[model samples]
Target chain A: MSDLLTIENLKTYFFKKKKVIPAVDGVDLKIKKGETIALVGESGCGKSLTSLSIMRLVPKPGGEIVEGKVNLDGVDLTKLTENEMCKVRGRDVSMIFQEPMTSLNPVLTIGEQLIEVIINHQKVSRPKAREKSIELLKIVGFSRAEEIMKDFPHRLSGGMRQRVMIAIALSCNPKLLIADEPTTALDVTIQAQILELMKGLTKEFDTSILLITHDLGVVSELAERVVVMYGGQVVEEAPIDSILNNPYHPYTDGLIQSVPSLTGEIKELHTIKGNVPSPDQFPKGCRFAPRCHKAFDRCFNEHPDLKAISDSCSVRCFLYEDKQEEEEYNV
Target chain B: MSKVLEKEILEKESAGEPKQEILRVTDLKKYFPIKSGVLQKTVGHIKAVDGISFSINKGETLGIVGESGCGKSTAGRTIIRLEEPTEGKILFKGKDISHMKEKELRKQVRREIQMIFQDPYASLNPRKTLGSTIVEPLNEYNLYGNQKQRLERVGELLETVGLDSSYSNRYPHEFSGGQRQRIGIARTLALDPEVIIADEAVSALDVSIQAQVINLMQRLQEEFELTYMFISHDLSVVRHISDKVAVMYLGKIMEIADKNSLYEEPMHPYTQALLSAVPVPKKHGATQRERITLKGDIPNPANPPKGCVFCTRCPAAMDICREVQPILKTKKENHSVACHLFE
Candidate 1:
């Protein structure tokens, strides 16, 4: 199958006051059909912005998608009208937000919310939509679907609320699902359950998922391909094994080293010193050079392109520039 | 494992004569009455902590692991008397301070059992400097009469947590999440409390910072001869830091055991499912392991399942599990499980 979603040099900017804040600057992404791609980064690194840009739902007032093409099956989503994009949202692509408690409507019943999505996207009556909602709830492993449907969002637990969010996202069975920090607010056990449920449901439906999270464990468990982002740019993209085993970019390396492992005793987790830079004050050369251990004069002076390293791995670092010159590597 | 064995040897020497107990909580319950409708009468209650019992030795970490709304935070808060418990006996050094007057408790037991809150950002007052925040406990308990001594103590405390003393003048916002947590730790240690209840102290921090905080806590626990009630949702962090682990669900203890045993051979089906779901960061694919995907979400704690709270989602749940609530029964030494399977 062709690429489910292809984003090339997508730039999302926020016109705060008068100054422009480039949140997602020149981001490139590709999601294959029935594949799971993880967008890994620290907070404020523009991973969430990329997802928001894909859904054409950048926060109002200041934020807008300024440049780049979001191609879904050869259709440029960025060029579409608001009504046209609305049609594409639930039917062609859907999104699961970060916090389930706030994402879900407090006053509305779970069944009402789920059915509303179905009724809005598809030509279905209320009764038919309600039936579909119940079926979707059951599909997401919510037993006692009838009872849960009647319950309001506040009445359910955190995990249950997240499940409802997933059910709503998957109500129309969109080909692609973009989950942004889906389990960040959840506890580990509940997070595991939700991750398993998402993986199972997505596999069952043969739906592609773009899992955005900072947790490497989740990526290792769920993702087939990994896209590591730093300072609003894709620093590294590779197969899961390659990224985990032999990450090329310094940022990806730092991320891997930082995650506390279950097997061995972690004496000292390697921390990337300094906070993620604000969008307005990005460095001139390598955005990661300020915190990278492998930074040199050359790295500080020049920005590196996303160069292909191997058949399965690509990295945006000066260290891998020789590999591309030696071998003609193509995706 | 060898390091653990060696640590145990060192603990025996450092612990000296085993004191009878440092802190004991019996049938601790914290219920918040929910009022609704036109009348605003007490319609129901949110039983955040419901009838839980545990004890802490003089110098050991007792980890409480549970999902959100499982009452782990409430249990810790109630133990520290931050939120008054509905019912329970908080026996400190054999003295039941449960019914002690607020003034009396604040004078005696409050300083002895300090608590670290979850959000470091909200915990520390923005107006106060790090020095003042840490020194407030010293002033409250009258540990130091002079300002110089208090400043010295604050500096020492900062040094203990691997932070520079120069950060004393910095406000909460000036520091990172890890640095702020260190300041919180320093404040908690100012009273030189016998028992410290760390309620998700490092959960808000990044993974790398979490490790640093955990290491600092372990070191401080050893140095201060402190007993800790470490409450957290991250099982891996809990397992690494805790000597004993208690698994809670719906404001009740599901299982409690030694850290190794709990992870290696979990008895309760909920524990099993929880353990299986934890993504192991090894080369071996987790897919090979049979993950018990609990069918339903956690039941509402306000009105939990009739018999067992876990029965709603438990895979090995039988009719007995649905008919009767299981009590915590000791299956082995230092191990207790609340499930019909054990019976």
Candidate 2:
């Protein structure tokens, strides 16, 4: 399959008074048709900002995408005019936010929300749009579809609201769907249902997903590939199995180790010392060098670029840099 | 107040005898009234917590794992007397403190039971320095007399929670989320409380910071011989920190067992589904359990099911499950479950 969306060296920054903070410093990503890729990171790591950049929806008054290309189906989104980007947003790329409650308009009924998206994107009659809204609700797993359409967002549960959100996002059959922490606000059982629904819908509609979340378990269960970000930069990108089993980046390894195992003997959890640095206070060299346990003298003075160690795996750490070079020389 | 209890538990553990009970709650019920219209006449009750029973041994941790609105937080609050119980008994060291007057309770029981809230930012007073916040409890109880001693005690408590003693002078806004949580822990410890009710304490932290705080809590438990009622919605965390685990749904415990039996071979249909619902990070194509996806959302708590609260969504629900509420009964050695299948 050919690539559906490709991001190259994308940089998003926030201007505060005189200083510029690089919230998303140079991120590169790709998703093939029907592929589901997860962008995993903590709160301030710029995973959400990267997704926003792709939608041409980075917040204004301070934030802007300053560099690189977000090419979707041979079109660079950053170069598009405001009016053109608005048209491309719902028809070609749709997004679901973390809090479904806040993302939805409270006053509007579920049917109105779904119908507006359909009418905005496709040339359909009012009656036809309403029909499509009910059908979309059924596809997202609502038994009483008509009753749900009449219900307000507050009347529905968090999981139900999220399903409605997904219904609207997929109503246009966008090529790429950006879901930022889609299941984080729900219960585990409900989260399981949402994950299953997303997995099935993406496969059935042939929609590519850029799932952004901090939960590794959600990433492990649904995504085919995983991209780990830290301090506004990509630290590792690999097949889900490699990232989980044989992770090359120290930060990735620490994250995997930090999660309490469900099936093992209870031992003291491994912790990465210190906290995630704020964007304004990021280190001069490697952003992770301050808290990394395996840091050496050189790691403190130089920042490492993401280097591919194998055909399918890449890492950003001084420890992996020498190993990759030695392998290339031997080859 | 807590030192005497600590010595007793240490003696019991050293002698290899059954552990002493620190806190016990029986048939605890808390209901908030719902009213309508301008007159605001009481119509019905939202049964936040309805008749739950559990006990914690001294120096042990009881993990209460459930979904939101399952009454886990309410149970924690009621036990701490933050919310008055509608009915039932709360026993602290075999003494009923459920109906004690507020003044008497504060003088006797409040110092022994402290709570750690989830949102470290909202829970802390932003305008106050860390020193004053930690020392407020000490001043309330009039401990470590004299201003100099209280200030010194604040520094000592900060260092005990893996923070620098010098940080006592800094404000809450000056610290990170993880550091603010440590400050909360230090404040909780200032009272030398025997039983700490942590309501979703580490749920708001990042993964790495969560590990650090969990490790800190475990170490503090060892040092102070503290008993904890760790209530959270995260099962993996509960499995890691709890010696005993209770799975709750619609304000009732479906199963209660040691961590091993509960995680390895869950008995109740609700417990089975809940454990399977947790997304375990696994290698691709790894062997995993067949997930039991529940049918619908939890029913309205005000109008719970006539029988088992879980029967609406339970996969293995039978006819009897819809008519008769299953009482929690011993199913195996050291394990109890509330379900009709075993009956």
Candidate 3:
């Protein structure tokens, strides 16, 4: 079966002043229908930019899709014109932003926001759209949907606003839902509710999700496949279990260990030594080599491409070069 | 640990009776009055920190974890007198400081308690050098007179926080988030504070950097003999650094206990739900866990429910919870819960 969304060689470049900084350099991603694929990375590692590039919503005047193909169901989204892209945006691909406060219009009523999306994407009357909007709110688990629809963004709490955003995102029942840190701004309990709602709703609609976040915990809970991104490059890609249990890439290993757990007590957390370098100051050889504990002379001088380590696991690191040797020994 | 021992010493001194209470807050309330129209009369109030009471041992780190608008930050601020309490008695070293004069408080206890804000980008003045930011507290407290002594103190503080004194001249913007946070820690330590309130200090940093900051905080707490009221929404971060943890709901503490006890065997239903919700990475396929998805949003503090604040969405809420508010009662040794079910 073909993927719901297939991104190939996608590069998003930021032209700050005059220098062209490649934020998402030579990236590849695939998301099957009803599957949740997580794009995990530290801040400014181009994870968010990759989602933006997929949606063709990169901030203007500075960023542009320098090169890449964003194919949604064999239809190349990159080839579409601005006007044509508008039709595909809410109908084919919808995006739920990180900050619900800013993403939602404070002046407009929740009903108006939901109705606008429904009417724009689908040929529905204003009355029908309003009714559908309430239904969407109810579906998203908002109690007294009619009452909530009358309320403005300021009247609702952060969680409620996020629910409204999800309702709007799912109103058109798009094939793909791109949630960029959907629960980042929410509390744990509220975040759990939202994640559960997203998971349940998407399954019901059989919708594919591109979950982008810095939280590894969310990735484990939501994603079937995990993509570890660093310095705008895919360092590791594997099934969620393989990536979590035995991460092949040093960066992925460091990230998983860094996550504080509740069940097992860790005496010391594995912390990556340095900050994620900006796109402009990206290291020459390996982006993670500066902080990687396993890095040696070869790691600093040569960049390793994503190599298949197992049937379901792939890693970009020199440490996993002799995969067969380790496999044979284990066998 | 040497740090834990240091805290014991500080606790002993602060408690005075060998069982000293470093900080005690009773019926703390901070309501931001919302006024409308030209009259601007005291119409309604946004009960940011409605009413809370907790005590911190002289040397222990007390973690305050709550969602936004849960009043954790406000509780910390009000306890420190950064924001004046509406109605409460903040007993520091067994003395009431809730309504103390600013001048007298500044001289007596202000320097003893310091705060580390959440946002490093906004907490430190961009215009001021890191040296000035660190030294400004010293100047305010009149800790030293000579410029040389002050510079020496600043340098010591920088070293204490694992930052180089050479970067003192550099602006805050020059440093990364983690480095800036270290600077914030250094600044908070300038007054030789006995108690420190870190308000979401590591929340804004990267995951890798968060561990570094948490370790630094743990180390500094011991070195300075500091008692901490660590406020954050992130449970994992709180669990990492805190000896004791308090779960806060809308303007009220839901549960409080030792870190291990609280995480291992949570008594409160809310705490259990919260713990279960946190995702843990597995080796293979996702393992199913009972996730209690709480219904509805947090109720507005201005018009909080008459009963238990958590009763609105609490799965284990009982009939009595709606008619009567539950008073925090001791459930176990050093553990307290405010749920009616426990009662």
Supply DockQ values for each candidate.
Answer: 0.43, 0.79, 0.67
CA lDDT scores, all candidates in order: 0.86, 0.93, 0.87
Q: Which candidate order results from sorting by TM-score in descending order?
A: 2, 3, 1
Name the runs in model 3 displaced over 4 angstroms: A324-331, B1-19, B283-288
Segments in model 1 whose C-alpha atoms lie over 4 Å from true places: A17-20, A124-128, A142-151, A187-193, A267-270, A322-325, A328-331, B1-20, B33-46, B148-156, B285-287, B302-309, B318-325
Top DockQ prediction, candidate number: 2
lDDT of 2 at A239: 94
Kindly give the stretch of ten consecutive residues in candidate 1 chain A with the minimal lDDT sum. A260-269
- Please list all clashing residue pairs in model 3, or write none if there are none: B15-B20
Worst 10 residues of 3 chain A by lDDT: A261-270
How do the residues A1-331 of candidate 3 rate in per-residue lDDT, one tens digit apiece? 5688889999999998878898999999889889999999989899999988888899998999989899999899989999999999989899999899999998999999999999998998999999999999999998799999999999888888999999999999999999999999888888988888888976799999999998988887889999999999998899987888888888888888887776656766767887888789978788789999999999899888877777777788988788745876777
Tens digit of lDDT per residue, candidate 2, span A1-331? 9999999999999999999999999999999999999999888999999999998888998999999999999999999999999999889999999998898999999999999999988999999999999999999899999999999999999999999999999999999999999999999999999999999977798999999999999998889999999999999999999999998888999999999987787679999999999999998778999999899988889999998898888888889877898879988
lDDT of 1: 0.86
Best by lDDT: 2
Residue A235 of model 2 has an lDDT of: 95
Docking quality tier of model 2: medium
Q: What is the C-alpha RMSD of each candidate to the true structure, in Å?
A: 5.3, 2.7, 4.2
User: CA shift at B317, candidate 1, in angstroms?
Assistant: 3.5
